[model samples]
Target: MRDDNASPDEPGTSTDRSGLSRRSFLTAAAALGLLPAGGRAFAEDKLLTFEKPRAFSFDLLADQARRMAMQPYIETKSRDPKVLDQIDFDAHWKIKYRPEATLEVADGSAPVRLFHLGRYFQLPVGIHVVDGDKSRELRYDPVVFEMPEDSPARKLPKDIGYAGLRVMAPDQKTDWLAFLGAAYFRSAGELNQYGLSARALAIDVAMPTPEEFPRFTDYYLERSTTPGHELVITCLIDSPRMTGVFRMDVGKHGPVVMDIDSRFFARDKIDRVGLAPLTSMFWFSETDRPDRIDWRPEVHDSDGLALWTGSNERIWRPLNNPPMVRTSSFADRGPKGFGLLQRDRSFANYQDDGVFYEKRPTVWIEPKGDWGAGEVQLVEIPTDDEIHDNIVVYWVSEKPVGRGDEIPLSYRLTWSKDEPHPAEVSTVTATRIGRGGIPGQPRPKGVMKFAIDFDGGYVAKLDRDAKGVEAVVNASRGELSNIECYSVKIGTAWRMTFDIKADDPEPVDLRAYLKSGDQTLTETWLYQFLPEPDSAA
Candidate 1:
């Protein structure tokens, strides 16, 4: 989830492109109009000397993926493992792409730059430019990149392909869209700061078995005729158990918008297939920090998972770095929308001016059509540091996908600072946990206290001593006591305080919402209470 180069201190291998040139070149050229005929034949002959443009279409790519899925999955091997190993983190940083070689598409709205192959990203992906019906593969060349003369990249062969690519702004300095490393891609969002990532497909994530990472083998980029329209990108995804064809219409006006249409074919039985899967980092937040390790108040790319269920209920579930991997599923018939959002936008909350965690983008997913019966699942993995992306959220259909089954999915991904459709009712602002007992009395042993804050909506209109306003609180398995709700002095936000008493050591699931008479005044707040570790043991 940390950009494509976020591998923990190890090296890997790249994918091979041995069977790329097997298709008929002359037939494809004739159909695509790449070669000139009659009078113009001699004029364009020099342009086609190196690589010939071939006829390409989305249907052709889908057919290729279908044919590949029928055959056994073959893992692409690295062409030069030793050379890639030498290009470690330090060496990789020094290898920069030349500015003059940027692929200027869409009337120069955003230029495309290739990412150099390195230790973290060893697999080489094919890059092509589609003009009209004809497409030409951008052959790998060393001259396009600048590196130190003593750099190990010089020792690699001339045919060493690129690892990934990024779309830079019109200025060609800052990158807004990037696609790199195992079907992973991210945008800077409206705030123009990269935070979380969205993967093409997720297989057996957070499961007992080792996770399978599918890689994008090839990419064909086409520019739009309209000046400000979206860029069209077609990609081929391959893995040991599946193959897919994805088409992304990507554009960045205020926020980055990606309209994705993909067809997936499973080669093996998958326990879970996460669609529109998002990956982020959440080390600690103000809600519950058992260990006050970091100096910053919070460290997270995304703070909570916001959901708009099929039943029209809006829910907010604060993310947690639990003691063990936890998977929470919310069943729905057809989900309206869901996303991992960084709601807290204040800079003072994070206090870190370097990375600007507060400016991180909120990624929202809006399903295009009826997804049928499915559940929005969130997987939280334990992490002590911010380097590892331990949080993942996605939609899993109730119906399972088996071998040879082709599933078509479509959705729109909005990378922005706020959720696409925010709840009309008051939302949970903050969640604080502490000792259970009163301040004057000795703290209760097997109890925990919670203080939740709600602001805006109808709750903000009420006075300090408003009548009929109530806090609806519940726990899965615990005694809830000492519940109080009142408006804070400094702001119009209402604070709800409560304590949960439990004798068991198992974690407790808690939910709370604000209500006035018979009307729900706020979105539901959910939290998982982890039992305090015994010091006497």
Candidate 2:
């Protein structure tokens, strides 16, 4: 399975805010009288005002995004090292936002909360509130958020800015939306356990050059009259390479969704421009597991990369935790949609009660306009555990992005289990891997077996002796044998079974999808088989 946890600052140093150190803040908050006493609430105002915007417009934000792309990049640093020094993981956790301090905004007037800076997040960000056509910035004060008497956050200075912002639902007890770090933003998804994150844009990810992370330097929040729909947020993105303005429309129905529209201004030349970029973790699965030592059967935030190309083909590519960084791109005229999906939504698969992996939501992105010619790219990195994120997928455009160039992007982000695009044909439901050979005969050396199940439409019509139904199997460096196609008697689906005998350790590229004569019955299922220890030639 994949990993969780936001990218905090570097580990070890007490100054780094990225969720590493713990003990410093407690000692300091006690000396400064910032600690909450015996459940007593700290007296602090939840709402305050910053600089007010005369007018609010999406175009204006886009213009800003475009304009920033033309200038040199500026890096934001902590102003008060003493306060930033005191704020660590434990200190940030201790400085809780007062329930009464919640700023009532949209969603029929619900309070929105703010996240304070800590060791994991030391840089300051501007927070603002928008009401109707008016917008104002919020002041950061130590008294605004109530904390424990011994809490270290109280020792921090008043002007230390917030790391990010979060929006609460109708009830102020829980938050459903959070814009925490960088361009990293996410809703609780459908399952409420924040799974994958959608970024504003991806620049040079998995590139040989150092990756550049753009930050939302400032934000403007405003309420809308639409019921069920809460506030509209306008974010100002700044980086060394580009600047962008984003308007996010957030709401809740069956699940939370963010309708994002933005314009980007490039300040420097970019080798790779990623649209609708998604970050996820894929640690281990049945196919990738070296040894089944873990108690939990399967582990991963997402199982596959689901893509609906402009060619009207739905493709499912399962993720892998490769030995090194691997990137794959599928060229298309205009991608209909794509996303990193958590397809296996069964508690039985992940047995983790504390953090229910099954309930994690799958995010789908639908481009609003003609994306032109671009390829959806998938990047996978090797990870030993579920702590580091290793999976990334995004749409890359063919056109070059240079300084002063303005790019407009709009997309609908869906946080749900099932994708909106309905498939007429049944899809690959499960993939299982095991050692080849029967119990009676000696097992063939360097042989492996794969069992794949297709659960839906065309498969239900397949007969045990179907005339046209056939399994097409291909390998990169191996001989295929014992290939068989059969209709499972218990279910209304067909099964494609195959075994591979490889002479070398090179990975075998396997492609299989249901086909009847010249007609294609199912989406292509792509898998890569890694050679065993003793199989290397």
Residue-level lDDT tens digits of model 2 in 30-51: 1111111111212223344345
lDDT of 1 by residue, 259-302 (tens): 88999998978889988899887889898875759889998989
Best by TM-score: 1
Question: All candidates' lDDT scores?
Answer: 0.77, 0.69
Q: In candidate 2, residue 163 scores what lDDT?
A: 73
**Residue 380 of model 2, lDDT score:** 82
Taking all chains together, each candidate's TM-score versus the true structure is: 0.90, 0.88
Among these predictions, the greatest lDDT belongs to: 1
